[model samples]
Target: MCLISFYLIFVFSMTLFIFGIYFILYDYSLFIEWEVVSMNSLSIVMTLLFDWMSFIFMSFVLMISSLVIYYSKEYMFHDYKINRFIMLVLMFVGSMMLLIISPNLISILLGWDGLGLISYCLVIYFQNVKSYNAGMLTVLSNRIGDVALLLSIAWMLNYGSWNYIFYLEFMKNYSEMMIVGVLILMASLTKSAQIPFSSWLPAAMAAPTPVSALVHSSTLVTAGVYLMIRFNLLLYNSWLSSLLLILSSLTMFMSGLGANYEFDLKKIIALSTLSQLGLMMSILSIGYSKLAFFHLLTHALFKALLFMCAGAIIHNMNNNQDIRLMGSLSLLMPLTSTCFNVANLALCGMPFLAGFYSKDLILESVLFSYVNFFTFLLFFLSTGLTVCYSFRLVFYSMTGEFNFSPLNLLNNESWIMLSSMLSLLYLSIIFGSILNWLIFSSPILILLPIYLKLFTLFVCFLGGLMGYMISNVSIYFYNKSLHYYNLSSFFGLMWFMPYISTYGVINNYLMMGQLSFKLFDQGWSEYFGGQNLYFLMKYNSQLNQVLQNNNLKIYLLSFVFIVVILFMFL
Candidate 1:
C-alpha cells in the first residue's frame, strides 16, 4: 500500500512538473488572487503569483522531490516508519511550493514557517541522539530567519499592507525602508546557512540521505536565495548587498577549504552544498539575480544527483560514510561511479555540463563587475578550491586502492535507486542549456584578456593537478608529513566553526546567564524582593500582632500623650 501511494505521488508530481515546464516555455505569467478579508480600510488577500521564474523553480522542485521519493522506496525499505517519511517529504514539497508561488509577505510566512517546522520534523525523524541534536540545531538556526521574517512583516505594517510587492517601488523613494532589506538579508543568511549559522548545515547530515538530497540540495537551502531573487529589485546599489557579497565570498572560500579536510562522504557533499550556496548568494549580492536563479536551478539538478550518488555509495558500503574506506569503486560499480563522476565534474563547472553554463557566466559577471581585489581574489580562489575538492573526492573514491575488503558490488546496485539517479543525471547534463535558451535571448558578452578569459579553465586544471597529487600522496603518510599541524587542523575543523558556534557561543551566553542568575534571581531579587520582603513583612506582622493584643491600653496612652503634647505646645 505504501509503495503504491509513493508511486502515485511521484506520477502526479511528474505530471505537474511537465505541465509547469510547458507553461514556463509559453511565457505564461499569472496573477491569481482571492480576497480573504475586507476590513474598514484594508483588505487581506491570498495570492499566488506564478511567472516564468516560479514555474521553473517549482517544476524543478517537484521533479527532484519525485525522484527522491522514488529513491527512498529501496533506501528506506527496512524502516517501519517509511510512510511517515514519505508524508514528511510531501509536506516539505508542499511548503516549498507555497513559498515558490507566494508574492505577499503574510502568505510567504505560511510557507516560510512551514519549511522551518517541517524540516525540524524531518531532521529528527530518526529519533536518535545525533538526529535529535542536529534537529535542535537546525531548528534553532532557522528560528532566527523566522523571527526576522516576522519582524519584517511587522515593519511593513507602516504601509498598511502586507503585500511586499507593492512596496518595492515605494521603498525606492523612502530610504528609511532599508531596514526591511537589512532584516530580509538577515533572514536570508540564516536560511542559507551563511557564516555563523553554517554549523547546522553539515550537522544536518545526521538526517537520512534522502532528506539531505532534497533539503540541502534543491529546496530548503535555496529558499533564502529564492527569497533574495524575489527581492533583488529592492537591493540595487544597497550597502546590504555589498555586505552580502563580502560575507558570501568568505563563506564560499571557507566551505571549499573545509571540504578539502573532510573525509565523511556525506559531510563533504554537505560542505560543497554550502560552497555552492555561497556562490549563489555572492552572485545575487552583485545584482545579477537572474544569473543567481540560473545557477540555483542548474545547481539543484547536479547537487541532488550528487547526494543521490553519495547515498547509494553509503548504502552499498555497509553505511560507511568515511571516504578513506572507499576507493576504486569505478571498476566495481560502473554505473554509480559514472554518475558520481559526472555530478562532481558538473559541480566543478566542467565545460558543456549543467554547472558550467551558470558558473562560467557567474565568474564572467564577477569579472565584469567593479569589485575590489579582495572580493575578486576570494571568488577566483574559491573557484579553484571547488575544483580542488571535487578532484580530491573523485581520487579518494574512484582512483586509489580499494581500502575496504571485497563485497558483492553487484548485489548493491538497486534498480530503483539507479532509475532515480539516472533521471536526474539526464537533467544535470542538459538542463542548463535548456534554461539558457529559454531565458536569455543571446549569450552575455564580455571582453577580457586571454589569461582572464581562460581563468576558470586554468583554475580548473591547476586545482585538478593539486587535488590528484595531494590526495595520492597524503593518504599514505598524512600524519607523518604534517609539519604545520595547527594550520592543517584549523582548515580541517572548518576554522573551528562547529566548536565556535556550539561551545564558543554557548559558553559566553551560559556564563552571562549564570551571572544574571546570581545577581538577579538569587542575589538582588531574592534578597530584596523575596527574602528581605518576607522578613520585613514578618516583622510588620509581629508588630501589628503586639499592637492588636494591647490595642485598648496603647490607644488610651497614645491619646493622653498627644493631649499632653498639645498642652505643652500651647
Candidate 2:
C-alpha cells in the first residue's frame, strides 16, 4: 500500500512538472522584458526583467523536480516513514516551482525563503546528531547571505522600484544601487556555497543522497546561478564583472581542491556541484546569457543523474558510501555500472557528453569576454582543473576494482528511477546539439568565429584527458602521493580556518587553553601581580581605621555643611 501511494504521488507530480515546464519552454519567446511603469511612482523608467532568461530558469526548476521524484520513488519505497519523506519532497519541489515562476521581488523572496525552510527540514530529516548539525550549519551559514539579499532588495525598492525588471534597468543609471546587486550576489554565494561562504555544503552531505543531489543540481546551488542569470543585464562594467569572474574562479579552484581531498563519495559530488556552479557563474560573468542558460539546463541533467546513482550506490550497499570501499563491479552491477558510466562521462565532460557542451560554452564565454589574455588564461587553467576533478570523481568512485563482495541488492530500479536516468541521459546528449544548431544559425545571431569555438573545444578536451590519465593510477597510491604532497594546502594558502570558525577550527583542549588566555587578558594584572598588590595595600592601620571610622559621619556632616554654605552664597 505504501509503495502504491508513493508511485501514485510521483507519477502525478512529475506529470504536472513536465507539462508545466515544457509549455513554458515552448513559448519562451513570448516572455518579454516586462515593466511596471509610472502607475507605481517608483517605476519611472523601463525595466528589463521577466524575460526569456527568467523563463529558462523556471524550466530548470521543473526538470530538477521531476527528476528528483523519480529518484525518490526507488529510494523511498519500503520504509514505514516513506509517506512523510514523500510529503517533504513534494512540498520541497512545489516551493522550487513557485521560486522560478515568481514574477516580482516579493515572489522571488517567497521562493528564496522557501528554499531555506524546506532545506532546513530536509537536512535534519534523519534526526541524528550529524543530520541535526548539518541542518543547523546550513542555517547559520545561510543567515549572512540572507541578510545581504534582504538589504539589497530593500535598497532597490526604496530607490529604484519594487519591480525586479526596474531594479536591473535602473541600476545602471544609479551606480549606488550596484551595492544592492553586490549584496544580492552575496546571498547567491551563500546559497550556492561559493568560497568564503562555502563551509556549509560539505556538512549538508549528511542529508539523504536524493536530497543532496536535488540540492546540488536544482534548487540550492542554482539560486546563485539563477541570481547571476537574472542579473545578466545589470552585471555590466569590467570592474564589477571582473570581481565576479575572480570570485567564481576562486570557488571553482578551491571547491575542486576540496573534492580532491574528500574520500567520501557524496562530498566529492557536493564539491563538484560547487565547482560546476562556479563555472556557471563565471560564464554568466562574461555575458553569454544564452550559453550560460544552456549549460545550466544540461548541468541539471548530468549532475542530478550522478547524484541519483550515488544514492542508489549507497542504498544497494547497505548505506556504505566510502568510495575507497567500492571497487571494480563492472560485472556484478552491470546495470549500475552502465548507467553510472554514462553519467560519469557526462560529469567529466568527455566529448559528446552533456558536461562537454556546457563546459565548452564557459570556455567560449571567457574567450569572448572583455578581459584580456590573462583572464582568459586564468579561466582556461581553472577549466582544466575542473576537468581534472570531474574525471577524478568518476574514475575514483565508479571505475575501480571491487572491494566488498556484491550483495543481493535490487540491481534494477523501479520505473521512476529508470525513467528519470534514461530521460536525463537522452536530454544531456540531445539538448546541446539542438541548441548549438538552432541558436547559432538563428537569423539574429552574429555567430562566433569558428576558430574561437574550436580553440575552446580543444582546451576542454585536453583538460579532460589530463584528469582522466591522473585518475588511472591506483586510487590508494594516488591518495597517498597527494596526501604526502598536501595538494589541498596550496589552495588554502590565503585562508586560515581559525579566523572564520574560531571555535570550530580549534581542538577542544586548545580551545580551553585559548579561552583561559582570553580571560587572563581581560583581567588586568592577573600575571602582573595586581591581585597581590591590592591585598597588600591595607587602607587602615589601628589608629587610621579608628580615625577614619569616626570621621565618616563627620565627613558626611561636613559635606552637608559645605552644601549649605554654597546654597547660602547662591
Compare the candidates by lDDT and give the number of the best one: 1
Per-candidate alpha-carbon RMSD to the true structure: 4.3, 8.4
lDDT of 2: 0.68
Best-fitting candidate, scored by TM-score:
1
Name the Cα RMSD for model 1. 4.3
lDDT of each: 0.87, 0.68
What candidate 2 gets wrong by more than 4 Å, as runs, is: 1-56, 398-400, 405-416, 435-461, 472-570
lDDT of 1 by residue, 1-570 (tens): 445755676676666656667776676778899989999977777988878788768878877888888899988999988888888898998999999999889888889999999999988988899999889889988999989999999999899877787788788567899888988889999999998788899988988999999998778999999999998977786688889998899999999998988899999999999999999999898889989999999999999999999999998888888998888889878899989999999999999999999999999889889989999999989989899999999989988778876753533468999999998899999988988877775777888888888987998889889888778788866654378889888987888888888667767888999999999888877887889988999999998888788578888987999999999999
> What's model 2's lDDT at 75?
79
lDDT of 2 by residue, 1-570 (tens): 334544564566456445545545564433334455757455433222334444445555556665666667677776578668767776776677666655456656767877887888989987899898778778877777777867876776575355665457777657766776778778887888776777788788888877887888877778767777767777876366778878877777777665655668787778778778877877777777667777777787787877887777777667887876776555556666667778766766677877776666566556655777766766776666666766666666557666765554536556677777777777767766655544443533334888876776576678778766766664544544556454455453324332354246434647788887777754665745666565556543544666567567878887999999999999
